[model samples]
Target: MRRSKNRGFGIALGVAIGTSVGVAVNQVAVSIAIGIVVGLIFGSILDKRSQQQEK
Candidate 1:
């Protein structure tokens, strides 16, 4: 449950950051897509680490 929440938060945070960067670079769509991918990767890594720590 907590892991899911973290993943969601990461994605949301990515969106926000991506939007800002996109606006600066004039590539909103591409930035958002990249952001989502990066967020997912980071989120999954975090989840894995958390799970490991729980053991």
Candidate 2:
């Protein structure tokens, strides 16, 4: 399946960061949650920027 351009960066980055933190702290779930939230913030910012560029 094709990846989504809008969300791909944030999600990938989030997961990577999250997994790293989680593994380091031994709190997989919490780390993943934090990562996902951060990723969503990043994704939203990116998406808004892209939309602005298109206009």
Candidate 3:
């Protein structure tokens, strides 16, 4: 979707942040998992809103 054009950036940013935090806490795996989940939730919200607007 045009409105969700930055989805990849959003997800990547989320993962990066999560990994950074995980590194700080020495929980790389858990932090990455949480980050990815959060990123997906955020990206989905953006995508849905964009689609709704299209309608």
List the global CA lDDT of all models. 0.87, 0.82, 0.80
Tell me how far candidate 3 lies from the true structure as C-alpha RMSD in angstroms.
2.4
Alpha-carbon shift of residue 42 in model 2 (angstroms) = 0.7
Backbone clashes in each candidate structure, one number apiece?
0, 0, 0
Instruction: After the best TM-score superposition of candidate 1, give how far the Cα of residue 7 lies from its true spot, in angstroms.
Output: 1.2
Candidate 2: tens digits of C-alpha lDDT, residues 1-55: 1225657788779978998999999999998888888888888888888778879
Error of 1 at 33 (Å): 0.7
lDDT (10s digit) by residue, model 3, range 5-49: 656656777899999999999999998888888777777778888
Highest TM-score against the true fold, candidate:
1
What clash pairs does model 1 have?
A: none
Clashing pairs for predicted structure model 3, backbone only: none
Best by lDDT: 1
TM-score of 1: 0.83
Would you estimate the TM-scores of all the predictions? 0.83, 0.78, 0.69
